[model samples]
Target chain A: MITDRIAVDIKVPNQTRYLCLIGHIGENIARTLRNYSGDREKLAYDLNLVLTEAMANAIQHANEGDPDKEVHIEISIISQRLIIRVFDFGEGFDFKQYVRPGHPLDEHGRGIYLMHSIMDEISYQQTESGHVLKMIKDL
Target chain B: MNLQIEDKGAAVLMAVQEERLDAHNSGELKNHMLKLFEEGKNNLVVDLQAVRFVDSSGLGALVSGFKNASSRNGNLKLSGLQLQVKSMFELTRLHRVFEIYTDSDEALASFQQ
Candidate 1:
């Protein structure tokens, strides 16, 4: 029940160009928490990869590559847990029904799968504003 | 996206000279690979030793290039996958789709076989 904690809050326009910034943010957060628990490089790598995938999904699929739209990112380190929430004002899909088809050559669907693989916990929900993706990792 | 194209006699070794291969620059890689494919250079090997990170968009570019090469009766191979890239391939079971090698030489040698 650790509330009232906000480490980072950012809102970027739904442009692919901003994806790199999100990766850097994730890396910086991991670096800042290097003294706690997990391997620093691995943590940074996972955070960067997961955040990039999540942001890309929001920019490309949720926002539909609309540069005018906005993607909100919230990072919180609550009780030694790193939590990230990405909000998009777009149509949300049924994440439970989606499965990674056995097409190794296919390109698009790997984003969600990678997010799930890297993060400790992942879920999608529809909020009053839009769709929100929540990912958590233990620090 | 930094790329280095080397003519390896029977195969072409295209090494990614960047640290990241994510959505921001994956389109560049895709376009470059397609350009090479259109030039009748189909036997391709993508060296990822220098690439420390690759997101789904990057993976998509490689797959698109693979499909393009396949349509041209040429094959695309992968070599020098760093741990992170290899993990992504394994996570998505893409290791079954692409011909992955330990090194560019091995990948180029496989083109002969």
Candidate 2:
């Protein structure tokens, strides 16, 4: 039994070039946690699903809605709780406006739906700096 | 992603190769599938054996395929889900929404009904 602890924080510019940051965030946060469920496959999938959704969401809904502004992502995990905050450096999004389930035949606007469903709790705070979405998942 | 449609017996099978079927390619894939179904070819099966990663975007593509096929009086099934991709299916519980088989051949044979 090993109780090695770890932590990582990354900053990424909101350029489309940084799209792969989702994969990185998943790897970092998953590594940071010490105590986790023994099911390797389940743990991998759960972490991937949550991180990918959150990262993609941040990329899509950046603060100022600026295509070039950088989005800030800070993630930290302590024991069983994984906390992730994705900040967008663009204009704010109309959270209430895009919450609909959308048309059945469409393939977009489904990110938030999946994210909210998978994470234990997901909340968003929009400030003058940008939009910050914080998510927590209990392992 | 490379998408190929196969007409096997009574089923129309679609093979998706590459990484994503989301915002960038979902529209195109939907258009292609819809066009085929419109041509009276139903009974769709998606072969995802080559796909390693899929996100919400990918899920949306599968869902769109499902709705379109069902709406047209046909059905859609998925086969050959890799470990990582299969996790997405189970995580979303969309696995329950979809008919998954161990392989593409089984998925095709299932359309005999």
Candidate 3:
């Protein structure tokens, strides 16, 4: 495992169009990890999914789909672990209150569930300026 | 949001041409499916061979289409899911809800049977 930490921070307007681009960036970054022992493709997919989901939530729900606002994303690899943080300047919600939808036919409410399932640790914190969602996965 | 629409007699085949189906464009797919349902073409075989990734919004659009089809006594099936996209369905336990096939031909054939 590489001992040096690597990190990338990005800021983008709160727009859905950037979701795919940011997701691909996350996937490419995961693909570059030299010490990750898990399936590289799977890791790439997970990172992409989590990043997309997190960004979507920040852009849509937290930012209230306000294109004027901006969302911040930070991805870091440290000690064989991948950590992701997404920040949005809006009122935060309780992450613990969300659970997987029980109905198979439900058309929504799966983003947070997927993020929790894919990441080892997930939390939402309120900062002085905004809210941040943190997700960590052991690589 | 490019989709190739074909009338297969038994069902309609809508092939998504995008590689990623997420919050950005899932709304368009949902709107297209709703429009098809309004046109009385409910039984659908959505070909996702080109969709390499699908997030919750994309899944939600498919679920919305599935619900709309079921309400009309029709069906909405999926075909040609990439490994990552398939994993999303499985992860959400939606694989059990939607009839999935290896390809569009098989999905359309199932509609005939």
lDDT of each: 0.85, 0.70, 0.91
TM-score of chain A of each: 0.89, 0.77, 0.94
Model 2 residue A42 lDDT score: 52
lDDT of 1 at B90: 85
Per-model i-RMS in Å? 1.4, 3.6, 0.8
Residue-by-residue lDDT tens digits, candidate 2, B1-113: 48887789798889997664444455577787888888888788999897766777778878887887888888989999988788767756688888999899999989986
Q: Can you tell me which runs of candidate 3 are displaced by over 4 Å?
A: none
**How close is every model to the real structure, measured as TM-score?**
0.89, 0.76, 0.97
lDDT for position A77 in model 2? 64
CA-only RMSD, every prediction:
2.8, 3.7, 1.1
Q: Which digits, one per residue and each the tens of the lDDT, describe model 3 over residues B41-66?
A: 98999999999899999999999999
Off by over 4 Å in 2: A1-7, A13-19, A28-37, A62-66, A94-110, B19-25, B38-40, B83-87, B90-93
Error of 2 at B95 (Å): 3.5
Model 3 CAPRI quality: high
Model 1 lDDT tens row, A13-93: 898888888998888777876346567877788888888988988888787788999999998987778899999998866
Work out candidate 2's RMSD over C-alphas. 3.7
Give DockQ for candidates 1 onward, in order: 0.77, 0.38, 0.89
Error of 2 at B12 (Å): 2.8
